[model samples]
Target: MYLFLSDFHFGLGTPEAQARRRQDFFACLDHYADRLEALCINGDLFDFWFEWKRVILKDHFSILCKLKGIADRGAAIHYLAGNHDFALSRFLQDEIGAQIHRDEHVFETGGRRFYLQHGDGLAPADWGYRLLKRLFRSRFNQKLYSLLHPDFALEFAHLCSRTSRNHSSRRWDVDGWAYREAARAKIHQGFDYVIYSHTHEPLLEPLGRGVYVNTGDWLKHNSYAVWEDGVMTLKYWGMPWMERSQEEGYSKRQVGTG
Candidate 1:
């Protein structure tokens, strides 16, 4: 089985909320560690991640350790960069054994071809953001930003992220038809599944003979997707069925039980 999740946006809320969410996320990593053949964190695991030489956020230490443990256990870890964490550097790759992908990735598993990405700046309607994305991602801009003290830079980035989140939260229900159309195009190009996360809206829909899935956000829905036995499913970790098993939870016995 393979597990996929995204839009964690850790470090967004209050300190207490952040800690609780981190524990919940760690539980997820623990729950699937034994059964996973591969794990894909499609993006935004951090609300704003910027790495400087000899500098690491203390808050990410635990999660990084957990990820390293999972990778050591032999599950392939694929970390796709999202808009929020586009500056993701070598720490995850060098220390946690992750395969980093900056934009999109394609691979074959479970007898199917999969296209995976963080789904940012994909909609044609989001052309303004797309333009800004290019600017923000430029090496020159990144270098200029890196000149600021990490303390000030990180705090400012987080504040900007919070403001962006507040604006986006109000439009959560807006349909992402553009993304669907883009997925359909990929389906036509021979992908058996096009999986992405950014809209933070969970969806599993058939497109032609293929499928399009959005794993949603850990912040709001705690949703994720799984591929097992040639089938794919979108499930919420906080659902009744999962809640019932919270005590004796997530054993190998539960592998295909979901």
Candidate 2:
């Protein structure tokens, strides 16, 4: 089975909040550690990802360590870059052993074809936002921006992550429209599912010829989506101690067991 999650948005809130949420996230991932064929993190694993040569996230170690353990057990990991965490360098690929996707990709599994993307620039309702995405992604600009001190740049980027110039009256409407269009185009090509994350919305609906899945974000509602065998589900992480502690959230985890 394949596991799908996205828009984690790490590093935005307080350190304590981040830690609590990360634990819940890891717990969910660990639950299916032994049965997964591959773990797919669709996008925005971190709120703002700018990889400097000497920089590191002190807080992500636990989460990374958990992923490392899973990889050691043999399930491959795939990461799709999100708008909030672009300009990824070599760490995730070389060190973490993840097959990283800078954009969308297609992979076949379980007798079905699946299409995946981070759902950032694919939504056209936010054309202005897409333009900024292009400017920020320019190689020249990335190089120029890389020259700033890590402290200053990281702080600035975190600030940028805190604020977004969203123009949509209803964000989900735009996301739904964009994903539907993508699904129609891909279904003609023989895909059974189209999965994406970035709008921070968890959606699973019947499309023209397949299913469109969004794994949602961990920032607020704590949601994700998963598919096992033929069962597709979106879960909120709720644990035994959920009401009092940080385990009060949802998760999207799947093990093929196929």
Candidate 3:
């Protein structure tokens, strides 16, 4: 089975809340560790992650160890860079055998082709963020930022992440249409499933012969998506994985994967 999750934003909350999120995430990993083919994190696994030479956020050590265990078990770890945690280096790959991708990743699983991306700055109207994305991704800018002390750099990035989250909360009501349209375009281009994770909203809207899936966010929904045997299901953590004959029979909080 291929398990997909996203938007963890680990450092955004109180210390206690962060601990709880980590424990929950660990439990989720443990539940599927034995059966996982590849664990795909769509984006924002951390609120802000940057690897300076010989420097990383010490708080993340435990979770990193847990992921290392999974990697040792031989399941692939695919980490797609999200807007919040895009500044990556070879640390993940070297330490845990992760495959880090800056943008989209295309692969075949269960005999279906997948188009996976972090889904940031895809809206035609989001010109400012698109430009910011370019600026943030520049090699020169990254090098300049690396000159700062790791403490100050990570602290500043966390503050920026919190501000970005607050702004996103303010605009949450109308945040997902652009993602859906983008998914539609990919579906029309012949992908069986187009998966994304920036909007923090879980959706399983059918587009012609394919499906558009947003794995949602760990912050609010604790939602994820699973692909097995050529079938995809949108699921919530700590809830029963109920299968229904009709899409409308599910709760309003649940998304239909049909």
Candidate 4:
């Protein structure tokens, strides 16, 4: 079985809340470790992630270890860079055997073709943000930012992230229709499944002969997707074994190849 999740946005809430969320995430990972064929983290696993040479966030060590364990046991780990945590370097790839992607990735698994992305700059209305994204991702900016001390750099990044999140919370009122439309367009382009994470809304919609899935966010809903035995499911982990079938098109089947 392949598992997909996104928008953990770690370090967003109060200290106690952050700890609880981290524990919940670790539990989810542990539950699927043995059975997972691959684990795809769509995006925003962290509120801010920047890796300086020879510097690492001590708080992330435990989660990193768990990921390493899962990879060591033979599960492929794929991480797509999100707007919040896009500065991934070689640490994850070298230590935990993760495949890091900056944008969209396509691959075949379980006899199905999949299109995966972090789903940030998809809407034409987000042109301003897209232009800023380009500037932020440029080599000149990255080099200049890297020259700062880790403490200053991380603090500045965190402040910027907080401001961005505040600005974005108001716009989620759109119900993610724009993202859904983008996904539908991809379905017409011949992808059997188009999976994205960023809007933090768990959704599964049948489009033509394909499917469009949003794995949702870990901040509130704790939602995710699973693909197994040619079946795709959207599930919530707010409570153990909780299945969300309220949507018009959803199922509650247990996911596995067995």
Report RMSD (Å) for each prediction in the order shown.
Answer: 6.0, 6.4, 3.1, 4.4
User: Which residue runs does candidate 1 get wrong by more than 4 Å?
Assistant: 163-173, 240-258
For model 1, residues 27-135, the per-residue Cα lDDT tens digits are 8778877788999999999888888777878777877888888899999999999878888888889888999999998999767999999888776656656666787
Q: Give the per-residue lDDT of model 3 (tens digit) for 48-118.
A: 88888888788788878888999999999999999888988989999989999999999986678899999
- Supply the global lDDT for candidate 4: 0.80
Minimum summed lDDT over a 10-residue window in model 2 is located at 239-248
Q: Best by lDDT, which number? A: 3
Off by over 4 Å in 3: 166-175, 241-258
lDDT of 2 by residue, 1-258 (tens): 788888777887888888888988888887788788889899888877777787766657777777788888899999888887777888888777888899987898777788998877666666767777887789999888889987788888866665442432247444467767876788778888888776676666666657667777787656665677665666556622211111222232322211
On the 0 to 100 scale, the lDDT of residue 174 in model 1 is 41
TM-score-based ranking: 3, 4, 1, 2
lDDT, residue 137, model 3: 82
Better of 1 and 4 by lDDT: 4
lDDT of each: 0.79, 0.73, 0.81, 0.80
Clashing pairs in 2: 1-256, 236-250, 237-249, 237-250, 237-251
lDDT of 3: 0.81
Task: Tell me each candidate's TM-score.
Answer: 0.88, 0.85, 0.91, 0.90
